[model samples]
Target chain A: MTMIVKKTTQLIAGLIFLYGIYVIIHGHLTPGGGFAGGVIIAGSFILLILAFGSDFLRLTREEAGSTLYENLAILIVVFLAVSGLLATGKIFFLNWIPKGTPGELVSAGILPLYNIFVGIEVAASVLTIFLALVIFKEELAE
Target chain B: METAICIIAGLMIIGALYAIHAKDLLSAVIACGIVGYGLVICFLLLKAPDLAIVQIVVETITLIIMVAVVLDSSREEHFVKPDGKGYMSMAAAVVMTAVLLYFFILAVGMLDPFGSGSLRMASQYINGAVELTGSVNLVTGVVFDFRGYDTLGEATILVTAVLGVITILRLKGRK
Candidate 1:
C-alpha cells in the first residue's frame, strides 16, 4: 500500500509476466505448463491489485472484456481441435501437422498452441474472478 | 529420503490439524496453505516435478481465493461445544482414521518398489511418447497428445466454472 511497495510491484510485475509466458511456451520441455504459468500470470496481476488497489488496474478494461477474452481463447482451442479432426479425418484432437524434431520449440504439433490458448483462457478467467471479487467488495463496503 | 518424507508428512498432518482447530478463520486458511505447500514438497520428493509445479501454483491461487472470501465475511469462528452425540461422532472419526491409516500402510507396502514398476502401459509411454508426439517430455506428450480429449474435457470444465462464477456474480448495470 505504500509508495515503496507500489514501486517494487511495478518493477517486478513485468518480470513475473515474462516468466509466465516462458513457462507457457516451454511447457513441453519443462515442468510448468499452461495452468501453472497462467496462475503465475494472474498472480502478477493480483500483486498489482494488492499493491495499488483494484481501482488502479480497472482503467484497462471492465469485467466484460476479460470474460470475452476467456471465451475467445476457449473458442480458439475448440476450433483448433475440430480443424485437426477435419484435416486428419481420423479422430478429434489428432495431430495432423508434421511432427518436427523432438526437443525443438516447434516440434509438438498443436501441443504448444493448446498450451498458449489454455494459458490465455486461464489467465483471463482468473483475473475476471479476482476483479469481480474486488468490485463486489467495494459495492458491499459502499 | 524416507526420513525427509516422513518429517514432511508429519508437518502436513500438524498443519491440517491446526487448520481444522484454529479459532481464527484467517489463521485456519493460512494453516491450510501450509498443508498444501507441504504436499507440494512431498510431490517433489516423489520425483513428480510436474505435479509439484501444478500443486504449488494451484495452492497459491486457492489460498488467495479463500482469503478473499474470508475477507469479505466474518473473521471469527463460532466454536460449538461438543455434546454426547458429538463425542460419539468424534470417536467414530478416530476409528475411521485408524482404519484408513492401516489400509494405507498396507497398500504402500504392497506397491512395487520405486522406479521398478513393470507396468506395460508406462513402458509403452516412456518408449513411444517422443516418436509419437514429437515431444521430449513424456509427461507433456502423454497429457496433451495421447490424452488430448481428456485435456479438452478439463478445459471445458474450467470454462464452465468461469461461466458459473460470472453468472452468479453478475450485478445489474455494473459491468
Candidate 2:
C-alpha cells in the first residue's frame, strides 16, 4: 500500500514462503503437513498482493495459471495413489515405495510425496480463491 | 493448565458475545477474530501443535478477508431498538448457555487430566506406527498412510469448493 509496507513485505514474504516449504517437506517428521504449509504459502502470496497492489500481479492471467496448477496438483495426487495400487496390486493408497529409516529426510515412503503434492494443490487453490475474490471486487467497482 | 484453558475459553465466550452485539461491523469482525485466536491458544495448551498451527494461519487469513470486506462495504450496522421479542431471545440464549456450560463442566470432570489422555483407538497407531509407516510423526503416518483415503477425499472436497467459488465468480459463464 505504502512504500514502507511494500519494502517490508518484500523482505518478509520470501521468508514466509520458505517456512511454508520447510513445513511441507518436514511434515513427516514435524507437526505441519500439506494443508497448514499450503495455507502459509498462500499467505505469503496474499501479503505480496496486498502490499504491492493487484495490478502488479496481473490478476486475470495469473488466476488461470493458479487454477491450472491446482487441478494438476490434485491430479498428480490421485496418480500417486493409483501408483500405489499398481505397485503392489493389493489395495489403494498402499505405501509401496521403499521405506528408509525413520527420522531421516527420505524416510517415509509415499508420505512426503503426498505432503508435497497436497501442499501444492492447497496453496494453488487458496491463492486462486483470494485472486478470484479480489478480481471480482475490482470488476464490481468498475 | 486446566485453569489456563478455562480462562481462555471464558475470554472466547466474551469475545463471541461482544461480536454478536457490537454495533460497528468492523469492530464485530475484530471481536470475532478474538474468538478464533483464543481457540488457537487453547489448541496449543491442549498439546495439539498441528491444530494450533493450522488454526492460527487460517484464522489470520479469515480475519484479513473479513476486514477487507467490511472496510469496502459498510462500517456501521443499523441498530434496531430491542423490543419484547428481542429481550425474550436474549433471556433464552442466556438460559441455553448456562445449561450448556453445566454439561461442559460435567464432561470436563470426567476427562483424564492434562497430558494423560487415553489413546483408545490411537494406541495401535502409536505402538508400531513409526515401524509400519516409517514416519517419525505418528500423525502424518496415520493421516497419509493409514488414512490416506480420507485425506484424498478431503483434497477432492477442497477442489470441488474452489471450483464452485471460481464458477460462481466468473463474469461470463460460457465465454
Candidate 3:
C-alpha cells in the first residue's frame, strides 16, 4: 500500500519464491511437496500484488501464457504416466527411470519429476486464479 | 504436551464458534484461519511434519482467497430476526451435534491406544518404502508411487477449478 510496504515486499518476495523452489526441488526428501511449495510460490506473488496494488496486474495480463504452462505441466505428467505404461507394460505411473541411491536428489524415479510438474501446474493455476479475480474486480469497479 | 494440545483444541473450538457467530465477515474469516492454524499445530503434535507443512500453506492460501472474496463483497451481514423456521433449524443443529458428539466419544473410546492401531500397511510402507521406491521420504513415496492415481485426480480437480475461475471472470467479446 505504501512505498515502504512495496519495497519490503519486493525484498521478501524473492526469498519466499526461492524457498518455494527449494521445497519443490527437495520434495522427494523433504516435508514440503509440490502442492505446498506451489502454494508458497503463489503466496509470494499474491504478497507482491497486495503490496503494489493492481499495477502488478500488467505482468499477469498475458493470461494465455500462464494457462499454457499450467496445461503443459499437467500434460507432461499425464504423458509420463502413459509412457510409463507403454514402456513397462505393467501399469500406469510405473517408475521407469533408474532408482539411484535413497537420499540422492535423482534417486526417486519419476517421483521428483511428478513433484516438479505438479508444482508448476499448481503455481501457474493459482496465479491465474489470482489474476482473474483482480482483473474481474477492476472491471467491476470500472 | 497433552495439556498444550488440549488448550489448542479448546482454542480451535472457540475460534470456530466465533467464526460462525461474528457479524464482521472479515473477522470471521480470520477466525477460520485461527482454527486452521490450530489444526496445523495438532498435525505437528501428531508428528506429521508433511501434513503440517501442507496444512499451513493451504490454510494461508484459503485465507487469502477468502479475504479476496470478502473484499469484493459487502462487509457487514444483515441480521434477520429468528422465526419458527430458524428455531427449528437451530434445534436440528443441536440435536445433530449431540448425536455426532456421542458417536465421536464412543468411537474414540473404542479405538486402540495411540501408535498401536492397524499397523499392517503402515509397517509395510515404513519398512519397504525406501527399498521399493528409492525415496527416503515414505510419505512422498506413498503419495507419488502407491497413490499416484489419487494425485492425478486431485490435479485434475485443481485444473478444473482454475478453468472455472477463468471462465467466470472472462468478459464478453474477449478471448
Candidate 4:
C-alpha cells in the first residue's frame, strides 16, 4: 500500500508507454502491428506496477476494471459482426465493410476496429491476469 | 545474432536451474519469468511473432498461477531458504548449462529464417482463408477462421476460468 514511484522509473515507464502508443498507431502499415503494440503498452504498465508495487496497480485496475473492459471489447466486436449479419446477409459476415482508401487510418474497414478490439482485449486480459495473481498472492502464496 | 543466441541460451540454462533449485518460491517464479523471456527472444529471432505472443501469454499465466497456488498452500518461511549451497547444485547447473547451449546452437545453425521455408504454404492457406472467411490480417484469418474451432475452445476456456474465480472467491468468503 505504501508503494512510491521513483522519478527515474516514472520517466522510463512513460517512455515505454509512448513507444507502445507509437507502435499501436502505426500498426496497420508496419511489421509491428496491434498485437505486438498492445502487448508493449501493457508491458509498460506491468513494469511500472512491478517497480512501484501493487498499490498503484490496484488503483489503476480498480479504475479500469479490465474484466469489464475485456467483456466490452468482445461485445463491441461481436456486435459489429452481428450487425453485419443483419444488414447484408453476406456469408462472409462483417468483411462487407468497405475497404476504404487503403493507406489512411480508417481505410481498412474492420481492420482498424479489429485491431482496436484486440488491443483492448489483450491489454485488459493481461492486466486482469496479472492483477488477479497479485490480489491472491497472499492467499495463494503467503 | 550469434551473441544474442548465446545470451538466450545462457539465460535459459541459468533460469531453468534456478527455477528448479531455488528454495524461495518467489525466486523460482522470477527465474521462470527469466526463462520465459529468453524463450521469447529465441522465438522472435526465428520471426515467429504469433507463436511468440501466444507462448509468452500462456507461459506467463502458467508461472503466475504456479506461484500463486504455491503461496496459497505453503508456509512462507519454509520455502524462503535453500537447503544447502552444495556440490550437487553446482553439478546440476553445469550439466544443464552445457546441454542447453549445445541444443540451441545446433538448432539455430540447422534452421533457415522461420517463415521463409513455409512461405508458399502459409500464403496459400492465408489466401484460401480470405476466400473462405474474408477476414483481413492473414494471421487473424488464420487464427479466427481456419482454426475457428480452436478459437471457440479458447474462448470457452477463458469463460470457465472467470467462472472458477467467482466460485472460489465466494466459497473462501463463506468460510
- State each model's TM-score restricted to chain B: 0.86, 0.81, 0.90, 0.57
True contacts kept of each: 0.66, 0.87, 0.78, 0.01
Candidate 2 reaches a DockQ of 0.86
First chain of model 3: TM-score? 0.93
* Per-candidate TM-score against the hidden true structure: 0.91, 0.91, 0.94, 0.62
Residue B130 of model 2, lDDT score: 93
Q: Residues A23-65, candidate 1: write the lDDT tens digits.
A: 9999988788888888889889888887887672362366778
**Model 4 lDDT tens row, A20-139:** 666556455444445666666667777666667667435444534777877787666566556667778764335567765545555554555655665666666666666655666534
Cα lDDT tens digits for candidate 1, B10-94: 9989999999989899999999998899999899989999889889988998898899799879999988899999999999999
TM-score of chain A of each: 0.93, 0.97, 0.93, 0.79
Residue-level lDDT tens digits of model 3 in B1-175: 7888999999999999999899999999999999999999999998999899989988988898899899879989888999999999999999999999999999999888766857568888888989899988888899989888999999999999999988888764454
Better lDDT candidate (2, 4): 2
TM-score of 1: 0.91
Question: Candidate 2 lDDT, tens digit per residue, B41-120?
Answer: 99888889998999999999989999998998999898889999999999999999999999999999998875774878
Q: What is every candidate's C-alpha DockQ against the true complex, given to 2 decimals?
A: 0.72, 0.86, 0.80, 0.13
- The TM-score between candidate 2 and the true structure equals 0.91
Better of 1 and 4 by lDDT: 1
Evaluate candidate 2 and give its CAPRI docking class based on DockQ.
high
Best by DockQ: 2
